[model samples]
Structures are given as C-alpha cells and as structure tokens.
Target: MNSYIRVSLAVLLVALAPVHSLFHPGVNTITPDAPKLRSLGAQQGILRSVAGSQNLKSQDSLRLKGGVTSILKSLKDALFPVETWEMPKFFSMSAMMFMIIYIYTTVRDTKDTLVVSTCGAESITFLKVYGVLPAATMFMLYYSRISNIFSKKALFYVTALPFMAFYAVFAYFIYPNREILHPPIPQDLDERWKYAVSLLSNWSYSLFYVVSELWGSVGVSVLFWQLANDIIPVWQANRFYPLFGQLANIAPICAGQTVAYFAHLSDKGDDAFGVALQQTTVLILAAGACFMLLYHYICVLGERD
Candidate 1:
C-alpha cells in the first residue's frame, strides 16, 4: 500500500505536465491578437457589472454571492498562511521558484515558436532525438564531475552563470546578425548538402531550444529544490510543500499570460523577434539574480538562527 501510494503521487505530478503544455498553443496562436482579447474581456466585465447594478433580482444576487463566497473560500484554503516567523521564508521561496519556473516555461514556449517558424515539424523531431538527448547526457556527465569539486552553492553559480552569459551574447549578437551569419541558399548545392544547410541555418534557434530544455533540469529540478530542502525543515515542509506545489502549478498560467502581453506589445515589423528576445533575456537574468539573492539571504538567516 505504501508503494502504491508513492506511485499514485508520482503519477499525479506527471499529469501536471500537460497543464503547462496547454499554455503554449495559446501563446503561439493568440499572441498576435492579445490586446483585442483583453479589451473584449474588459468590455464584457463592465457590461456585466452595469447589468447587475440595474436589474439584479434577489435570486440572481444570491447565486452571485454564493459563487463569490465559494471562490473566496477556495483561495483562503489554497493560500493559507503559516503562523510562524518562517512565513516570509516560505513566501519568498515560493515566489522565487515561481519566477524561475515562469522564466523557463516562457522562454521554452518562445523557443518552440522560433523553431517551428524557422525549421518546422521534422526539425523538432530531430531535435528531440539528436539534439536534446545528447546534450542531456553531456550535461549529466559534466554535472557529476563538478559535484565532486564544488559545493552545492558554488555549483549553482558554475551552471547558471555560463547560461546567463550565453543568453546575453545570443540575444545581443548572434540572433540580430543571423541573416549575415547564414546567407541565402545557393542554387548549386547538392541535395544532401542542401538538407544539411537547412538545419545549420537555424543554428542559433536550435541552440536556444537546447539551452531552454536544460534550464528546467538545472534551474528548477536541481538547484531550486536542493536549496529548498536545505533550508526548510521537514516539519515545516510538511505544512508548506503542498502550498508551494500549488503555487508552482499556477505559475505556467501566469507565464503564458505574460508572454502574450509582451508579444502584443511587440513591433509588427522585422524588429519583433529582436524585441521579444531582448525582453525575455531581461526577464531570464532578473529571475536568476533574484533567486540567487533570496537563496543567499535565506541561508544567512538559517545560519544566524
């Protein structure tokens, strides 16, 4: 029965993956018209408020009050605060994790959009097999090596700083000069050469996709949780872990909406890609910095106490 319960919990966690994926398609399709959607929602809300004020029957009002009450009750249960000084720590850690996960999902979704736009379906299939699997293998090997050399706190920097630098360089240099770096296709190339060229042409996008894939493993699955476990006591974890898990489940929704909002603000012309990349780069850096600062602060507090 204990083993069965463990398997059931694991399955429940795996099921949440689809919830995050559902946010991606909306970002890809609706981003172009995000402003219009927001406006429409606002108009509907206003109309509903006006109608309610003018002609709300007692039955309708009762139903509305019941719905609102139920929503408030659910919110209270989901976000119930701990009665301790560690409440700030719990909230800060939760917020930091949420930001890290949000950055990962948003960037991953954006990278997917670029990959599909630049390469296509077959390229995605090739990336899943040839690109990501090999990168994952190499990363694990390197990570294992460094685990012996560096403390866990230092290991976080060893992994994260390089990624941040690469992103900065890619956003500022490679992406903007992509066309210059990879010129138009020549008519004289052989068929096999042409296929190779097609894949090589999207080199930066492919690299972005690979790095984004690794971010989840390095940032969220490893570093963030490791830090959490190091700080939060087991008894406190029993109370806050479920709330943190719930916050994590809500993060992808917030991330998707943020991506859509930014995409809506993006320029309509050739500068759109650059603008989007720059914006996401800022967000990625900010999330990493904030997470590290909070991690350090929490550790200091833990040590002092």
Candidate 2:
C-alpha cells in the first residue's frame, strides 16, 4: 500500500512539472510567435494609414526607402522643387494665373470686337494713342502714390477690385445702356475723323477699351507679379512660372470657346451680346475673387512654412 501511494505521487509531480514550465519558462526561452506578432503589428499600422488620410495631406514626407515608387517620387520632387505638402500652394498659384489670363482674354476679345464692329478698326489706334496713354499714365501715378500709403495687399485690392467692379457694372449697366448714354450723331457722319468722333459718341465702349488696356498693363502685369512675388521666393518662382504660363495658356482657349458658344446661342436672339457680356462678367468676378482667395491662402502657407 505504501509503494502504490509513492508511485501515484511521483506520476502527479511529473505531470505538474511540465505545466509549471509552460507558465514560468526559462530565462533563455524564445517566444515562438514573436516574429509573427511583430509582422501583424506592422501590417495593421499600414492598414490604418491606408484607411486614414487617403488624401495624403496628413502623410509624413516619404523617406527614401529604396522602393521603386519612392525613388520616382523623390526624383519628381527634386525636379519640381516641391514637397508633397507644397502641391496645394503650387496648384493655387497656377490657378490664379489661369484666372488672371482667362479674365484678360475674355475682356480683351470683347473689347476688340465692340470697337471694330461699332467704332471701326481705326478707332482702336486712336484710343490706344489718346485714351489708353492718358489712362495708363494716370494709373501709373496713382499706383506709385498708393504704394507708399498702403500695404501690398491693400494696394492689390485697390487696384484689382475697382477693375472687377467696374467691369461688372459696365457689363450690367454701362454697355447695355450705351445707345441711350451716347451722344446723338449724324447718320451720314462719314468723315475720316468721324471714327474718333463715333468712339467719343459711344463713350462707354471707349471707356471699356481703355480700362481693358490698363487691365492688361497694370492689373495683370503689375498686380499679378506683385501677388506672385509676395508669396514665392525668386529661387522657387523660376521653377513655377514657366509651368504657370503653360497652364494659363489654356485659359485663352477656354475664353475663345466661351465666346463662340455664347455668340452662337441664336435662341438669345438680339440679346446674345448682352447675355454673353453678363455671363463673362460673372466669370471674371468669380475668377478675380478666387485669385484673391488663393493669394491669401498662399500667403498663409508662406507664413507657416
């Protein structure tokens, strides 16, 4: 009976010893599942990243991780002189240029068409000499004086806002009411100097042509550059300007198509020009507003970066 009890105790000890080893392993014991746990954690991190911030705006700058895609992206960044975070800034500047050029094209085309169709082509030469020269001179003086008194941002608003507002007002009120606004002239007024007189008679169109010219010279050439230079450093601007120019070139094409489409809207009847003018003005105002917005955003980015 004693031998049987001792043998049963020995068997219990052997079985329990292995169970104790599992709960309290040796110092040098390696976890069998450690590698798999690490791999699963890594996979989950990647999945979380993929599910979150899909737009990549929140993504960390890609490290040069020796992958093919990473290497290509790095090269692209180098060539463009831009980081992932800088894309919005870049695109905003480009879009601003686009809007500027679009407004210019739309206004200029319509100006020329109005001049040639109503006042004769020769009147353009006269207006360029008399109207544009005087207006530009005054504007240059005004710009020079205001530059001293106002901040660049304020100056931009002063210079640009008036043009946009006047354009809107002209489209809605001035041009449409030109016949009533103009002076009564002889039906048989066929003098060579009659072209200039006719332009003077249709004074709204003359004013429109002059404003359009000043817009090209001042609003576009001066204001746009001022805004661009304010946001981007010269070193970085060189890389961006060429691309901006190329992208902005599309605006002219779009303007042409817009004009054509509206001009051909025979359903508008005799009011086609009026409808086109109003629609184009809306676009110009929208573009001007957006350009200012982008300028503000880029300025914010510049401050932050």
Candidate 3:
C-alpha cells in the first residue's frame, strides 16, 4: 500500500512539473551572456545598458531583445570603464539566486514542515475581506465625499498612476541614491554599548526591508485580486482566474527575454530609448487595466434590475 502511494505521488509530481516550472525563478529563459554585454560596454566607457542599446538607430549596434544570451551580453557592456555596475548586478543576482534556492527548498520540505500555508492564506483573505479593504474603501469614500472627489474610478487611476510613475522615476533616480543612504557602521566598537548600538542599527535596517517587502507584496496581491473580482464574472471566475494568472506570468518571461534582447541592442547604442519605450509600455498597460476595472464597476452599478 505504501509503495502504491509513493508511485501515485511520483506520477502526480511528474504531471505538475510544467506548472511548477512556470513559477520557478531559476527557470528563466534569459541566457547567461547578458552580463557579458554589460561588462564590455563598461570597458568601452559607452554606458552599457539594454535600454541604452535599444535606443541606437545604427543597425550595427547591439540591440537588447528577448533571449538568454542578449541579457548577460548587455550587462557585460554596461559594466563600463571603472567596472562599477558589476557589484550592483552581482548583488541583485545573488538575491535572486538565494530566493530561488530558498523557495525550492521550502517546497521540497513542505511534507515535513509544520508550516500552516493554508492558515496564512485564510488570515490574508480574512484581513483583506473584513478589515483592510473595508477600511480603505470607507476612507476613500469619505475622502471622496468631503472633497467631492472625481468618480471613485478616476481616483483609482489617479492614485495608481502617480504611484507607478513615481516608482519608475525612483527606480531610475532614487534607486542609485540608496548607495548614499547605506553608510558603513562603525566596527571599532570595543565596548558592549557600542556593539549594542550597532546591532540595533542593523536590526532597524533589516526591519525596514522586511516591512517594505511585506507591504509591497500585500498591496499588489490585494489590488490584483480585487481588480480581478471586479472585472471577472463570478460564474467565470474559475476559468478566467487561471488564464489571468498565466497572463501575469508573462511579465517575468518577457522581462527575461527583454533583458537578453536589449543586451545586444544596447551595445549598438540603444539603451536610453529602450528604457523609455519600456516605461511607456508599462504606463499604457496600467492605464488600460484601470480603465477596464472602472468600466466593469460602472456596468455593475448601472445594471439595476
């Protein structure tokens, strides 16, 4: 009986392999050559970048495009004269690698791990359904009434758009500014008090990262799900949910390919323009999503039987 159960489990695992791979961070389609392009561009003092490369009008210049090789190659060029971009790219890659490994290990250990994954899901749904969304809706509605705010739909777009625009701008600007914020802590702490102070400081930074990640994940997840329910019919939820979720996965796949394609393109002098193009594309997507959601809600309200 135990052997039969093991065989059945093994078959189930095989059946689910493709679905599991879809979400696996390590299973990226982006090639390893992308970093090489960034490094080369760095060596040439050409400001190596997928975005930069994509901007070049010259047909000879490398164009960052969708592929594994293109991404690493682009990064290789981006490294430039002083080899400065390498460290940041390394750190980013390391974090990604660690996340992939950690998630893989956790999934494997789920059989013996006492983690209440379902309980956490329930807690999230409970909070969003009962507490968070309700509070947010009330707050927004109240503010809307007092301010005679434009349609809730307009407010949603207004809130979402500025945040997105800010994020893109911040990524380009404030992201680099982080290096300035991270000063080296004094290691000359011979005293216990100094050590305690250093420990507290480190803890504070760690706490900030944890809070940021948690808030970002929760906010996006809640917004997407709420948007889904608003747009998708209750009867079609099961069918459309899977489809939409798969569509969302397209971002990572596309990012990977873009990273590759842009690597070569950037080498040919197209990075800046490519970056602008991508940013414009994202903005358009956000606008379309917001419009659909608003339209759906309007339809729901108008259909009074």
Using TM-score as the measure, the top candidate is 2
Model 3 spans with C-alpha error above 4 angstroms: 1-155, 176-181, 189-220, 260-305
For 81-173, candidate 3 gives per-residue lDDT tens digits of 113533332222223222222222222222111112212222333334444455556545654574465664554455445434543444355
lDDT against true structure, model 2: 0.82
Query: Compared with the true structure, what per-residue lDDT tens digits does model 2 show for residues 156-268?
Result: 78888899989999999988887789898678776876987888888888899999888888756897777777777888787787777778889999989987877776345
Candidate 2 vs 3: which has more TM-score: 2
Local distance difference test scores for all models: 0.80, 0.82, 0.43
lDDT of 1 by residue, 141-235 (tens): 99999999999778888978877887888888988989888666566878555545555677888888898898888888787888888888888
TM-score of each: 0.69, 0.73, 0.33
Among all windows of ten consecutive residues in candidate 2, which has the lowest summed lDDT? Answer: 57-66
The C-alpha RMSD of each candidate to the native structure, in angstroms, is 34.2, 11.1, 37.1
2 against 3, candidate with superior lDDT: 2
Model 1 clash pairs are none
